[model samples]
Target: MERKKKTGFARYINLVNLGVFVVVTSVSLPIYWLVISSLKQPVAIGASPPQYIPSPFSFANYQQAFSQYGFSQYFINSMIVTVAATILVLGLGSLAGYGLARLPMRGKTTIMLTLLVISLFPGIAVIPPLYLMMRTIGWLNSYQALIVPYTAFNLPFAIWILRNYFLGLPKEMEETGRIDGASPLRIYWSIILPQALPGLFTAGVFTFTACWTEFLMALTLNNSNSFRTIPVGIALFGTPFNIPYGTIFAASVVAVVPIGILVFVFRKSVVSGLTSGAVKG
Candidate 1:
């Protein structure tokens, strides 16, 4: 009986391992292909019997993306919009989250529910109205056009994450600060914000990623080359007659680098923030 039980447990463990292997491979294969494709020379990219491994790895595509295709401008535009939006989201979200989590206010539940609903509204559903508004205000084809919308759209999720994180913190800390005659803002800035680093990092990462990869709004709002983002710029890479797959792949790899680095650096904090407040109000 003991031997049979051991065999069954081993079989289960093997199955779980196989499942993990399959999932990892499925996710990684495409990324591997993209990286390899980016490294291959332009002619070699679509060669017969696609090169699984780039024979003569060359960075000509990357150079062409930056110098020839003006991807540098797109990269800069994306960085500006993403960074500005992320900063605004974090600054505004922390305050709103702290208030919702700690303050004694009427209709708090209703407000939170409303925020969740608003966040769920699809970008496509709201784009027409947003485009009209931007056009009316003469903000079309500008950085603020994208930055403002990104901040507004990402703020709710940041607030929810932060509010939940704040709730999980000890109330006694706030009470102690109050006893010391510390103002709410002072206490929050000094005591609360420091401990909420994990939540902040998580929110920042998510907001940054969203703003970086956002397509529909970016495309609709900023159509001009001067204001085009990575996604928009990548889409317009080559003319209909001749497509530049190598350059597109290189640009994509470049765009993915920042996000990959950010996530990797803050991975632990992100994991902790996401899980810590999950069950705490």
Candidate 2:
């Protein structure tokens, strides 16, 4: 009977391992293909037989993406919008989260729920009014057009994450700061925020990713090539006559690098923030 139990446990472990392997392989295969396809020569990209391994890897696609396709400008535009939006989200979110978590505000739950509902609204639903507003304010084809909307859209989630994190922090710290005569703002800036770094990083990374990859707003808001972002620019890469798949793949790889680096660097913080208040001992 003991031997049979042990055998069953071993089989279960093996099955779990096999499942993980299959999941990893399924997700990684496309990424592998994208990388290799980006390295392939333009003519070989659509070859009669697919080149799983790029023979004589060429960076010509990358070069053309930057030089001919003006991906550099698109990249710069995306960086500007993403960074600006993330900064605003973090700054405003931390304050709102702290207020909601610690302050004696009435209807805080209602406010939070409303924000959540707003966040759930489809981007398409809001675009027409947003476009009209931007046009009315003369913000179309400008960085603020994207930055303002991105900040507003991402703020609610950031606040939700940060509020939960703040709730998990000990109230004694704030009380002690008050005893020492530290201002509320000082306590928040120096005491609470330092300890909430993980939440902040998580919020910032999410906001950056959303703003970076956003398409519909970036597409509809800015028609000028000078103001175009990576997603829109990539979409408009080729004319009706010819599409450059290799260049598109190369641009995609480049676009993915920043997000990958960010996730790799802040992975621990993201995990901790996500699970901070999930379990209580």
Candidate 3:
């Protein structure tokens, strides 16, 4: 009777899991169908029910996006800006966060609150002055225009995340480093920073994604093709009258895959980083 009860419970659990799988698959099927439809030829794509798989699996859409839109240049530009910005945010933000967490100073709370408030403001709110400043510095239509602003705008949020994570860590670790004759910067670089890897990864990933997908600033700031990033280039798929759904969809998939992989591969670290000291403070 005991064995039979255990087997029955196992079967019930399996059935519940199968039901969940089916529901999830059902929800995702439409999205899969939409993406597959982009790879299909226009004639077949416009058909009544639409096809899941493309007939010939044509590379035409990707080819067109590359050739006509100069998407390759845009992709490279976006990659450069995103990577550089992510690095800056990680390095500077980590240090700033550490300082905010450990160092005592006058009006630190006021300064931190000010930063949080500024970060909460919408991009459009500051675009006019920011644009004029960029133009005055002659950074308009240059890589610096995009990368500098991307890093600066993202820094506040990154700092806050790192600060929170740092606050969670115990002070004993830093004391141990200092007892071993480590200076402030040395202690930060070797001890506290290393321990905050998870938070760093999480912040870096978020910053990278934000910079990668940012469109409004990229569109307005870069008028020339040479400085255009992926989001701006993707916008070209839609003219006044017509939109190239296939090319847009394919490029979007291309854009998303890397980010998806990045987060997926580092998910454990990101989660661990975010939740590391949640229970304490």
Candidate 4:
């Protein structure tokens, strides 16, 4: 009876594993197909029943994306925008979070709720005002146009994450710093900051991903070919006359690579950040 029960439990575990594998594959198959399709020639891309493998694998599509359509410049623009915005978000968000968590305020709860509400506002709703403000300030077609807005829009979530993480930290160290005559900034820099690495990385990764994948603001804030980021460049890849599916697919795969690499690198930090507040320690 014991052996039969163990066998049944093992079979159930196998079934669960199979279900998870199926779900993961179902989601990943499209991405797999996209990557495979990118390797094919233009002629093979749209072949009926779809060619599972490239008939003659070629790097021509990738070359066209980078060289002919200027993905290289778009990539640089995206990097600048993503890196700058992420820095801004992490800096401002950490400071804001520290303040909200540590400082005594009469309406702090209300203030945090307001921030959460502000973050929930539709991005589309703010575009007109943001566009006009950027135009009025003569920041149009500038990296600042995208970077600044991305920072502002992503700040609330960063602040929320960091603040919750901060709240979970023991106050003993902070109190000791206070007695040692360390300035508030010094305490934050030395005491709180070191302990908050996971939170900072979490906020930074979130901000980076947001800025990297952002499209609407990228499209609206800049119109110059030189200023366009990857999304816009990819969207406008083919003329109205011809859509280069292979090149588009190749560009998409290229675009996804950086984000995947980033997440893979910082994945441990992200996991730590998310789980930091779950238990007492």
lDDT of each residue in 160-277, candidate 4, tens digit only: 8999889999999999999999988999999999999998988888888888998999999999998999999999998999999989999999999998998899999998998984
lDDT measured at residue 38 in model 4 versus the true structure, 0 to 100: 92
Q: Write the per-residue lDDT of candidate 2 for residues 1-281, one digit (tens) a residue.
A: 99999999999999999999999999999999999999999889888878889999999999999999999999999999999999999999999999988989899979989988988989899999999999999999999999999999999988888998899999999999999999989999989999999889989898999999999999999999999999999999999999999999999999999999999999999888878831221
Q: What is the TM-score of each predicted model, taking all chains together?
A: 0.97, 0.97, 0.87, 0.94
Q: Please give the lDDT score at residue 251 for candidate 1.
A: 96
lDDT of 1 by residue, 79-172 (tens): 9999999999999999999999998999999999999998898989999999999999999999999999999999999999999999999999
Instruction: Kindly give the stretch of ten consecutive residues in candidate 2 with the minimal lDDT sum.
Output: 272-281
Best by lDDT: 1
Clashing pairs in 3: none
Candidate 3 vs. true structure, TM-score:
0.87
Q: Over the stretch 1-281, how does candidate 3's per-residue lDDT look in tens digits?
A: 99999999999999999999999999889768767866877567677775667887877777877888777898999999999999999999999988988988788888789888979989987788889999998889998898988998999988888888999888999999889999999999988988898899989888999999999999888888899998888887768898887888778777877688989999998888777842223
Number of colliding residue pairs in each model: 0, 0, 0, 0
What TM-score does structure 1 among the candidates reach?
A: 0.97
RMSD of each: 1.1, 1.5, 3.5, 2.1
TM-score, ranked from best to worst: 1, 2, 4, 3
lDDT of each: 0.95, 0.93, 0.86, 0.91
> What lDDT does candidate 3 reach at residue 198?
88
lDDT of candidate 2 at residue 71, scale 0 to 100: 98
